[model samples]
Target: MNHDHHMKITLEAILPSHAARPVKCASCRTMLYTTQNDSGLCETCDEKHLNTLNFWTAAQKWEELVEMNRWFIRGDTTTAPYHIGRLWEETDPLIAQLLELHEYGFITIDSQPEMEHVSLSIAKKWHLIKQRAYLTCVLPTRHSLIPISKIDGLRTNLLARKDLLVTTYCDNTTYPTPKGQGLQDAIPLTPEYKHFTDVEKRIYTFRSTADKDKDVLTKWWEAKTRLELKQGRGKFTESRTFWANNTSRITKKGSILTGPDDGDFQAAAAMRPLVFHIAAREWDAGMEVVGMLVKMCKDMGFEKTFEKFEVELED
Candidate 1:
């Protein structure tokens, strides 16, 4: 409105520093020594409370360096993800790694949205480290809902459903044993128990039979085909379902159970490990079966796929 006053303001803006030198941080009011601030934090407070770039993982940094370098090699350096300051807003490790790469001068981040979008896409496809059974709660429970530290006993002689109740302090706890059948160790299901333990979602795939028996795979294939054919464009009913983390480590983790993960058989068979459906019921038959397999492997001799086998029961 006033041309002379406006000219003075414009001259001041061009001459003065953008940030004002404050004695203390605007947020925490902590003492500021070397840092010249305009309502900003000191280095310590910045890293503790606000800095997201400070939490980079070494492995992820190396990886993003590779990825961004690939883009750099294509003669395009200024992409959205590389320039996004938003990527360092939260303590996500993947974004932290990206920030590290940017700091290293490989990436020149220009925008926020591309970095956020790209980082999120990478996060979605990221895999979790799958856990096999250790203190696995068998009692008709999903594996993810069972907290790793909450299980009571060491990994030896674990039962899922039959009266084996560990003392867990669930909210508003009440345990009632059924009449005449006598399930003193029956676990009570609670809303707190269900939701409180759902920490991380892990994924698993196929597990092999104990002896690497092709028969099991054959049966799986044949039965799956038969059942699929029998279904005939209807909803499939899987009578027997088996799941394992992988085909290896049958010796380390227990032999893969051939039945359902949640086979509430009204007995000890109701819980984790899910080994009720084994054809050979006797424990001696277990050794005999393994021995025969070992003999076969030994007869086949060295230079085979397996170096050796040891029957170990570990978590």
Candidate 2:
């Protein structure tokens, strides 16, 4: 794809009345009217709340849990970055319930937001990445001999293959791109060139990594040599130049471009692998969020569209 797209699908959940809007102080049940006191506690109770057994017990339990998980917990007193440890064993029952929900993947609790606003917002970005990867798989990389009579037939076949691949492997229901636009936009048609008198010609191009598959180059070179021997030297050179000019190379860590010296066969071999690598890396980055979504769906006893991503797990 020419451009990198980042699409996010947010999942939200409704909170209970008590958690959504607090009418009374959490500790003493006294009517609350202002935000002056933290933890939604009345002044009298707020001072005593910190020394309670429940508070200390919750803290100790959280500390032990982090230790078992081998994760560090730092104190975020006044200007420190917000961490889950900041809510260690809170005294208020409602806050504690919210914290538990955050821990279990039911909600995403950000330290900057009010406890009530910390609703679940799972981003379906990884799922989109996998869809992009599937689209890349159908890209036309291998060159096949085409007869003049079968040019239209080949185009029809290519279209059918793309449609089938996208419909089968992609979650099209929520895919941000319009139907028939995602992969089609990436695989552009090559400029027309006259090849032999009245002969039908088309080039299927894709991006690839350099130096990974030398055998592909060898095969193409062999085919080129045979074609040149039969049809004269310059007959096949034009097509080869077209392929080389359009083909991209994965030269560095995050770079992809059409090098000036790349040959047609070398470009063809490198295109698909390079595109696959880019898509796979993007998919892997979002797998953590995807896993959380899977867990949340299981916990809620509901099947999500993403749960159908079992097809992607296969090689």
Candidate 3:
């Protein structure tokens, strides 16, 4: 859940001066020193370029200048002999470009909860940028966790069964309901009481005492729902329930299920809910789906509201 408030935009490229060449300032046309003209501009002209409000226009011009000065898309040499000065300063020009982009709905900016920022490598992966020299802008974000409380609707039905196997209900017909009669009512009086009725009943003894147990169960349900939304009914049920019955060692203590062996218990108990391990296994896949959605938004070149993001979960 860790994310940064500021989205960092980085402009990186092999400047025109990366190759051995005498480049001139594209703006001022000044005969610049080799080190001073690496960016195809002298310090004064570079400052002026950064001062401009239009990033797209400036970027196009910068690309042209780099091409004019023999900037290579890919380089043969591993190292450059001279230093290329910073392309744009963090002054008014950079701010103006960011503001323009924000105003035009090309990027979004909002306050986000404090958390560890995503690493540069991760950001590059998310953005699908492989080029060495490119512009990146970090837009501030307002991100919040999808509330796990919705899982409450599924809790009683899911946990009430005697079998430890996890099950997914796609329709209301197969879904369980709250035990309205009595705990003793769950025990059938006769082996012949197999008549079909309006309600489907399967029950087990449940002692709902541990808050931690409920938390893990909530996470488990959330993961299941996300999987269902991403992969649809068939794959979600098949994949998530792969090891559902491998719970021979699990014993119920209150509402929490503890593993039979100390090692298993330790692993499960390390987290609040014993089911967290199961959910975490699917985390990467779920995040991949999320990343795909983000890439889609970027490609569409629009800022979406939080509700729009929620709509993506609709099954």
Candidate 4:
């Protein structure tokens, strides 16, 4: 981690009502206005209003709350930057709360404005390290090919907590995977270059707006075609294919990014679609591409492949 990076985060300020528009003072009961500087409270109370701003700024009470929120979720001591924290000074209470929760670690935050749901960071450590876990897919080349007796040993001592199985087949060779199916318990998956070409790659990309799963199924159909040809079956011939075609479309135009303003709850909630994308692949080679995807997804907490199970292959 980079010691130079300081986690700077901000909390929103709760200002007096009509601060933006000038209103009557609570004490003087005079109608002070901003447009004319003629309504609301008198000049005497204006000094008090200035003092209020000064007090809030000095207390940094909001910052304290934001930091607390981050700790509650991430259990990390880091936070966003100073400028990001300052933005909340103009925001409302709900927005302020959300920013604090985001800074702590409820979910990943992107600061980019163009990307919807983006999160922001004040500072970050630049150190890098690597570790291994079970439920991870590895390629065949990396396979240790343990004995049957050691299955329990591998599961208990080596395997990660989540077992992910993803597959893709040609349109013709595709078949419905049985419910409750998962990666092989005895054979752990790994990443290998040789297996990449064997991918039952999807032919079309899934879109949330229209005909969602149809594209995925269409690619499945392409994969199945290869399997059918091997069995001497002909081209696609299904009047009942409509259901398979449209199953994966997303009805809502969901955000792909999040930030401190979204809070921990919403940030976590936003990740479901992203994780689904990786999970829904037609087939997984255990250690090949699927393994690569899993490694990325685990860090993302499952958003890598949750949505958009469709693809458009290049010629």
- TM-scores of the models, in the order given: 0.14, 0.17, 0.16, 0.16
Model 3 worst lDDT run, 10 consecutive residues: 306-315
Q: Give candidate 4's whole-model lDDT.
A: 0.25
Error of 1 at 155 (Å): 17
- Candidate 3, residue 244: lDDT: 24
RMSD of each: 27.6, 26.8, 23.8, 22.9
Give each model's whole-structure lDDT. Answer: 0.23, 0.24, 0.24, 0.25
Question: For this target, which candidate reaches the highest TM-score against the unseen true structure?
Answer: 2
Residues 1-315, candidate 1: write the lDDT tens digits.
112221211111111122334556433343444473442644443433221121111112222323333233232321111221123332232333333322222222211111111111233332111111111111112223333322221111122222121122211112122234322222222221233333211111111122211111101111223334345432323222122221222212221211123122121122222111111212222122122222332343312221122211111
lDDT of 2 by residue, 103-181 (tens): 3212222211111111112441111001111112111122232122332333233334311211111100111222343
Clashing residue pairs found in predicted model 2: 207-271, 208-270, 208-271, 209-270
Give the residue spans of candidate 2 off by over 4 A: 1-152, 160-192, 195-261, 264-315
Per-residue alpha-carbon lDDT of model 4 for 247-294, expressed as tens digits? 211212222222223222221232221111212223222332223433
Cα shift from native, residue 291, model 2 (Å): 27
- For residues 149-202, write the lDDT of model 3, one tens digit per residue: 222223343344332223221110111223343322221211122442312222
